[model samples]
Target: MRYLCLIIAISLSSSAVFATEDMDAKLDNYRSAVGKLMKVLKPELVNAMKSKGPVAAIEVCNTKSPTMTNAVSQETGFVIQRTSLKPRNVSNTPDEWETKVLNQFEDRKAKGESPKKLEFYEIIENDGKRQIRYMKAIPTSKPCTICHGEMIPPPVQAKLKELYPADKAIGFKVGDLRGAFSIIDTITQ
Candidate 1:
């Protein structure tokens, strides 16, 4: 049984690495799709801010769906609206998410480069081997800080609370990495 367990572990680790690679490829595709949308959306959002005001721009963000999957906001641990590919699910606790991705952003931030985005790779450990399974993250910008920043406006705070009752996503600055792309691959076990 011990030997069987070891074999299973080794197999899982190997599969996890392959999964991570596959997820990375998918994340790249997702970025390309969203990058195209941002080109048009950014300008429009900026225009709305100038004419209708920041609220209008925020409203647009609230409604926009850059991807079909929901994206995580690293700042508050809140998931953003329709963005990302399927299989990108939220964790029950902030710690769970942090262990998986947010801490990496913090590490990058400590290095002086803001984590503008993140890619989550699922790592599986079996025996003595480790491998990545999948990855994903969200794009961040100045506006993202309004809600995720160190000081969230009351309206934004209220909205966030409503959307995420157990939210911890907040206290971020402009140009900071708001979230990362996550990758999850299937284990070949």
Candidate 2:
């Protein structure tokens, strides 16, 4: 009986330790991936605004990067079918996470607070397994304002409309939530 108790206690304690370590590693991966993407995106956005204009820069972001989309898939089970300045219809795949994050961002703006590190969890099923995923929103910077700001320049606005007819991704300021770091089952390995 003493040996059985000792063995059980050790097993439970070890499992708990492993769980903690797993969570830590997952978060580290999430941060590393997001950090790498931002490092690349920030400079490009700044340069685009300085040389090309806000619209041009945003265009680059729209087509060029899949940091958010890829992250959603890798972290969560869901695939981001589309992320537009405005909402659009897709034959399949709902934009549930993106829409929720965006709405939270707008609410934060209305409350005169910068949305940062906003998080939420979603339960999902993948390959017959149940999983929980997390989503986080981080604000855009000063440079981001030019494209997603309250008052875009006329030319920039025109370009935005042309590019994103149903665009709803505007009316933001520096330090306001531009988007989020969505995490899914892609928790730590």
Candidate 3:
């Protein structure tokens, strides 16, 4: 009887370890997908800013960001998107889970954690479907300030208002959390 109990304990322990490892692997895959998406976005944004200005860069973000995300999602078999606590695009509004995570990220930032390195992942069971969700925070940088800062130039402000009338994505300072890349990968058991 004691040996049977010991066997059961070992089995449970091994199962927990295996579950943790599986979660880690899934998180790694999500990170790689997000990284690829960023690599595509950054160069395009930089070139646009260099050639035209912040207005053009904003256009690149508005038009090309989603296309790049979709292409990466197709390649990785994951749903990828960007969301913010205060979104510029209405379509980028955070869902319930995302909102909760974003709030937690804000709390972490308030506690002096580096937003650039902030990330979260979990495996969730919804309606009998298992899905792995990951989020990586986007910290505001110098270039980002040209469009998303507290003091936007008049022309840039005009362009932003024209593009996003209800934009709440301004007033960000350097090192602030701008938003996050969200990735969800369904796990088929």
* CA RMSD per model (angstroms): 8.6, 5.5, 2.9
Model 1, span 131-156: residue lDDT tens = 33333345457766665577777876
What clash count does candidate 1 reach? Answer: 40
* Ten contiguous residues with the weakest lDDT in model 2: 85-94
Q: How does model 1 fare in lDDT?
A: 0.51
Candidate 2 whole-model C-alpha lDDT, 0 to 1: 0.61
lDDT ranking, high to low: 3, 2, 1
Scored against the true structure, residue 112 in model 1 reaches a CA lDDT of 71
Models 1 onward score TM values of 0.49, 0.65, 0.87
Q: After superposition, how far is residue 11 of candidate 1 from its true place, in Å?
A: 7.7
lDDT of 2 by residue, 1-189 (tens): 999999999999854544656666655655555566667767877887789767678766776555555654565354333333343212212256557766766676687754655555555556655545555566667766677888789988887788767667788777755556555553223
Residue lDDT tens for model 3, 63-99: 8898888888898888999999989999999988889
Model 3, runs deviating above 4 Å: 1-18
**Candidate no. 3 TM-score:** 0.87
